[model samples]
Target: MIYQSFSSIANAGEETCLNCSTHVVWIAVSIDGGISFTDYQVYIKPDVTVGYGHQFVNVSVDQAGSVYLVYNDNHNMFYSYSTTFGQSWNGPFRINSSPSNTAIFPWSSAGPAGTLDVVWYGSSYYDGVNPPDSYPMTASWQVYFAQNLAATTPNSKWSQTTASGIVHYGGVCESGVTCTGNRDLLDDFGVAASPTTGFATIIYTSDQYVNSANEPAQPFGSGGGCTQSSTNSVECSHTDIAVQTGGTSLLSATTKHHFQITKTDFEQISNNPSLTIQVTNIGNEAINALTAQISGLPLNLPWTPALSLQPGQITTATTGALPATLLLAVGTIYTVTITANLSDGTTETQTVSAIYTLGAGIGL
Candidate 1:
């Protein structure tokens, strides 16, 4: 199957203004390996300004067929995922770790199941928030990368780092042909992981300073011979690639530390309520040790006994019984977190929550 994403402009007038125009993201799924698409849907409607919001929309599918879509809006990167073949999506989660840096041209690539890598042009000085009509972009840009090893989990953590040196030192107007300032780096870049090595390779455009002599020069705006004004300099237009040197490999046949957690209530034992927590190794890899912890109850329980779980194995452990006399405040919620320690020296967690009512049973 193939997943594709693109952007569309809405509420356009004969002459568009920054606030008047809006941008949206659309997605399509192809079962025949991109030969033809049967389902086309609009995932996100026009919410932000048309210029930067919907630019550089990209999509990638993981080994398990989960689709990931990423885009930039308001100088920030947003990501969403779909597992049911584009029938529904999880979020428009902000993936950029940096709050102040400007993120643009976000591109994504899925590696192993639940693993994803994203690359974009990030700038320290330019937040890309100024009015479009007034050219307001000015800053130094670099290739920034972020990865989520457990992307399928809720509130997954993303690790971010700088992938390359300064690529450009100026304002980047993403306002298409009507851009007023520098649009030198163009629009988007690309990222992909090697199936064999599992390392990510990023292909991007660079405008870093390089003298006509084909050697390193000073910084772009620092009176460098290869400044943007010197259009003749080769540094003004060049393509470069960055390869991951040290990191976890994205290529794993078995889903790395992937599991599912389910909590079920058992009948009252000795007039005390009891709960059963089950964990299933849904991935191909076997979990070396599995444990669970429960919180938000009258009494919190520590980690449960470790259990080895093989692929497709489901194991259950009982939680401490709660006495009927114990008083739980209104709207009391119980949280169960299941953790899996993989054989590869990595750990993953899945959590479930249940709310307790006065007379009614626990609702998950």
Candidate 2:
């Protein structure tokens, strides 16, 4: 699981082997501009039986630098959080209140103001059904959502809600002999949150009706008017992607910082090598200042002054034409390193090496 934070990149995965008797979840954080990462264990539990659904792990980062992780274990959904940037975790709390039902494919997102939302599919009725206390492998499933107002708080309870009308018409089989055409909702779901509005959009796949077909004539020995023969069998089911929004009002405004260098170009200007670097503020919030530094050249580059870069906007900084003495010789490699320093104390760096060559008349 890869997540983007205000000032860093985070990821979560199983540190140990999935086939091992015991499995653990590890979260890694890259604060030095995503160049290196530090990892920590979030939780550990007994591995699920082989041939079961895949273990899906998800991670999200809030505006305040808190990290949230959710995964499925033992046919139930659970979540844990880290406040110190993956240094420590708070809980393996079960999000689903019902112990008898199975919940899987958890997807989590964080709002601008530190709110966390999680959605999953569970063995519950599609319509309004309180306390989903039944466990039927082949039963219908519904979409469920939970909200955590204070994600960093320890042992915080999640407010649960069910999105009605969506149904899952699939099942898991234990043995190959009893396997039907039923399929498992493989891997994951999607969820996104707007940093400006705090509105969340959840998308998932469900087996809805695909088409209708006429019934086939049945034989005399058969007790039905129409038989489900191979020719007339209606495998008319589709894994449809459905989208839903959380019913919540907009939250307060929050500040975010995301600075990145989108592209870099190197060329010869007037027979002298030159470089141009483009930067962007890929975050929801604005950046006040960013500085660039170039290395592997004799010339001293100046820092870019306080630059206000809005989201999706790009800014370019170039190295002026080199002196005549700095002209490159053919068949020689030159290396350069460019570093961008944001006002928020975060730095991003890029390195490039190019082999220089003159026109056809030039010789090495």
Candidate 3:
């Protein structure tokens, strides 16, 4: 069931836009399993000048139906595979081998038939460190994940598996948007596997452009935006959505260790001021028990509840989590519920109603 379609993401679809100008084009999609798909394409740059169009393209399918793809250009991060399923595809492989400006999102996880489990979002490929000595010199982002067995060696078909599973974003910005300025958008994605314990799970999301009229938040790309230090930080990266899980067969599905919750009251609460918490447990193991609450607060001065979090703050917390360092209020006329454990083991639940103010607080 793989068949994705695209056309101007506000990038404008000028005359059908086939990879913008070619050079490298591949946004293809067509599968009949995940359910519904026939054919979609953009992939074409055999070489307008060295096949260059590599913009956000991701495709995965394994287990026997071979098909893998990845992207990211500016310096590196490219790979291709297709055992005739996608019609025919191969080598593009560079794997962030070198250069700079790195940013990959390659994702995959289809095992058994020939083994596959790719991942991305890198800044230091193999990690031996080179390029005049680099590793967080700017906005270093890392999440590397790998798997592509079903062989003996040759780099082992595909390798990486995740020597790193920690890349995050969250400088927060969304009311009027201005942790500094604006710019941040990552997607929420998923991939899973558990032959029994070969274990594998993934989640994604990233965006943190903290202020931009130009530069910093980047008015376009080419120049503008900095803060990566070996993996420095900034860009207000928030919108958090990253879950990781690896071989352990996911402990037989789950003996217990999952949880999730989200809240944001103001549906017409009048007052305005606090309450805004989010809880998650995408699973990779970890979430030993939790809790949260908020009945009302400050005489409703700024209204309060299961949201509005951080700024001055309120109360209610569990094993302790909302964003992590602290922030989870539960007051100001609202409701929130949470439940956990997932990634095989089982158990899941969540309740919500962070109400909204229809008059002065906005939400009418």
Candidate 4:
């Protein structure tokens, strides 16, 4: 299934909505193994009347196929639900856990046979005014969560939970306290979660709980500059949720790099060989180095050769290492080989080729 930012109307990640010119839309196609697919698109519009009134990001559908959406409207948090496979819909349900308002982080997941858990960062006000409960802390919302498996979509009972998120007290404080702070500190689609035997658990970021390093009651300077009541302006804080899975592995391509070189007319020494090369890292845990070897040569002239390269695994970044220099003997051509050994007890080799014109001795 493919998801996007509401612009893929004609599909292929291109389409956009005509009404309201809003790009907040979604489409999905459920593929059956390698056979066929069930496709559809459903638009979610916020109701300015009842709900908090805003758009949402990050929507999740459980095994039974229930949809939960979260977003921020006017700096405030708002939520909504969708059943019937996203056919018709329902009004936005208020998950107001912020003080003044907040920009919803918009992420959710459901247990294998359990309930759906959604999370976000914002004020923990609960009250519809300025003085919030915890002041924009981490919050969680669970719907129809029970010790047992789920029976259907949109479970009648859902639970909401909010906390002050963890705090980091800097080792160096004016009065023996370590501290730092930040909200909306993260942006990405990766979070730690798991579901087992109808019971699901999740770990997310939060900075709600305000605890002083010296002790729970002992504040920095004992509320020297700012009173114990207003800690937001004094202490520094930021929270990140690390959810460890059973195990994880890094990609192979990240350990190696690639580089390229090119040559043109008047650069060839002679055309007697068309070269193709491949490299090998005889014995090593990683390809810590890359260089060209031109044994059948006349002079120490750089090949300025063009090399072809291929990577082994997927990566988060688009850059890789390339060859810096290649000196070849014409007709003798050259083979640019790459060898690598990774930390995971693995190694591989890739070769590239180039052609040289005969009798041509690098004419000026």
Candidate 5:
């Protein structure tokens, strides 16, 4: 777990706060999947030059179990990672491609081995208001995204892009619960990767112009899906999802073939033996033809007639009734290989294990 807190001192064996200037991010690890956590350790403590210290500390763990840490320090986004869970870290790398006057509320999601995606609110101009201000931040802000396909590598180049249109025309205060200005955006938004496409999907809030007059919404004054009237002046905030259109996928596919085994069925009968496999096309492109064959049974099943499958479609290949001599042993484990041929001229292979029982059907 990660948190932000003021600095502390050991005053006669009692911990004492040392003022807000020493604010820092603390981290605690739970080896047992969060059942319990280790003692908190100071993770990030920015220098006095940045002032006000770091806020909104976030973390993400990749497929390889590397943990990524992100936070906003003096209007800039910074990140670090630990291959050792939280034991050791290896970064202080910057996330934004260009310098920004204000960047805050950073959130990150990890994907396939060594890939990570981050999103945060940012603006080219700084409103110049210190936290806990009575007014809202006045700088126009938009959601920004930074992706690193080789995140495990130190200082890997990050691909930066704008994730959303200007979300707000005014400034966003970073001083949670303290500043009174335009806190409609709250503190943070989040981002995640698509399981099949590997693309980054970000969910954020927006208060867009609602009526034809282009009136901004409430907090910005009577706009956004509202009827700009004395009684009906409140406009609802929008929860939006930004999908990445072009970029290297977080789902890193080593093979061009993008199909997956969805289901498999096996039957061990004396005279009516059958085995079927289901494959789903998960890629953006359609498969003109697909065929499959299974091996490791008493008799290897021959490849079935080639069939076509559209993107996101699931199709089945079956080895219909075979000769009675093609018997399967009950209570015996069998590791089977399924090879699929795609029209794209790529062949994909997968393996599965199955066991048959006298009454219970064959389990795959």
Candidate 6:
């Protein structure tokens, strides 16, 4: 068995002391049959003016003794990893890809070879797009998943994916003073991963409709008169747990592509005389063709040759040579804009600036 710990301000007294003013979270572990354990701080903040809710800390351990901790700040979900048990950690990385949305109730599981997956409920209401009065009791909570290929490493990049359609609803408190009524929020969600297959299953709570005879009803205001009488009709609080399964083999067919300038080598016009830029594809689909264009330079840089890239592939393009006529002064900053057009009918642009230095320098 394994254990974990977290912090909260709920136990604070009325006196305005440090403990009462600020909120923090921590985690601990006991590997040897719960005999002894080590503690590690997850999040800490000194300032007490801004209230912080550090809650929902979930922990998962892999066969290799690596520990993963996932928690929420009441607004977003963040995760951290500990290679040396609970003595140290690396992360507190935001698990939710969308910063504007509210993410909470994070749960995680570790699969074979230290593959980690985390899930949370993402709400759109917090973004001010779906007000309760307009669509009250509707499905606003969406389930999101993030996977870490190398869960044992601090530098592991998380790939975010959506698991369930926006059908899960309820668990949200009403507006105003009575908002605290649904504080429990349907207990919690859970996730598990297969040690061999690396497949993951997520189980979470959601509202549903039941007939008067206690039978399941169709979703989305279908069977049974379970919807609210108001304009933004929502089903009554009939929380039910649902499950969803996913793995690498069950990838979505839709094509997606993410482009980034991974590396840039720049130098003074008189010294190195050329600029090298590297582009990488971080998505799940192959890039049919890619075109790179650079602007904000003294000379009109031509577009790079069209190239093809598989998922997770990197390609480099360099300016053949900077003409000596372009006198780039030392310590002068120059903006560089790179636009990439993909055959997938998508275009991405990155604007970066670099200072003309004597030695090699980097751009975004």
Worst 10 residues of 3 by lDDT: 295-304
RMSD of each: 13.5, 12.6, 23.4, 18.2, 10.8, 16.4
Instruction: Score candidate 1 by lDDT.
Output: 0.63
- Badly placed stretches (over 4 Å) of model 2 are 1-22, 32-35, 46-53, 125-137, 170-184, 210-246, 249-364
Off by over 4 Å in 4: 2-25, 28-56, 75-91, 97-103, 112-114, 124-155, 166-184, 188-193, 197-239, 242-364
Sequence-dependent TM-score of model 1? 0.58
Using lDDT as the yardstick, the better of models 1 and 3 is: 1
Q: Judged by lDDT against the true structure, how good is candidate 2? A: 0.53
Evaluate all candidate structures by whole-model CA lDDT and list the values in order. Answer: 0.63, 0.53, 0.41, 0.33, 0.60, 0.55
Q: Pairing residues by index, what is the TM-score of model 4?
A: 0.36
Q: In model 2, what lDDT does residue 60 have?
A: 84
TM-scores of all candidate predictions against the true structure: 0.58, 0.50, 0.24, 0.36, 0.59, 0.52
Q: Give the C-alpha lDDT of model 5.
A: 0.60
| Alpha-carbon shift of residue 2 in model 2 (angstroms) | 6.6
How should the candidates be ordered by TM-score, best one leading?
5, 1, 6, 2, 4, 3
- TM-score, cand. 6: 0.52
Q: How would you encode candidate 2's per-residue C-alpha lDDT over 13-65 as one tens digit per residue?
A: 43343444335566765433344565676775543321112345778876444
lDDT of 6 by residue, 250-277 (tens): 1221123266555555554334556666
For model 1, what is the error of residue 35's alpha carbon versus the real structure, in angstroms, after optimal superposition? Answer: 7.5
Descending-lDDT candidate ranking: 1, 5, 6, 2, 3, 4
Better of 3 and 6 by lDDT: 6
- Best lDDT among the predictions, by candidate number: 1
**Global CA lDDT computed for model 4:** 0.33
lDDT of 5 by residue, 1-364 (tens): 2222232221223224334343344456643234455544434454423432433677787644567878776567877776654666776788885544567788899875567898888777644555322224355678998888888789888888788777766545566777555566665489988867788888887655453343344443444243334221115455567888876777654235466655555555443445666666766656665433334434334323345667778776667543455456643434455555566677666655433322222221
lDDT string for model 3 (1-364, tens) is 2434222222234336454443444444432123334342334443333323333466665433456665544346565665545545665555543322354445556553345566566553333333212333344455666555642122334445343334443221211233242223344445576544656766654443334343243333333443342122333343333344444332332334243232233322244333444453434554433344433221122222443233223334322112233223322224444444333455565544443223333333
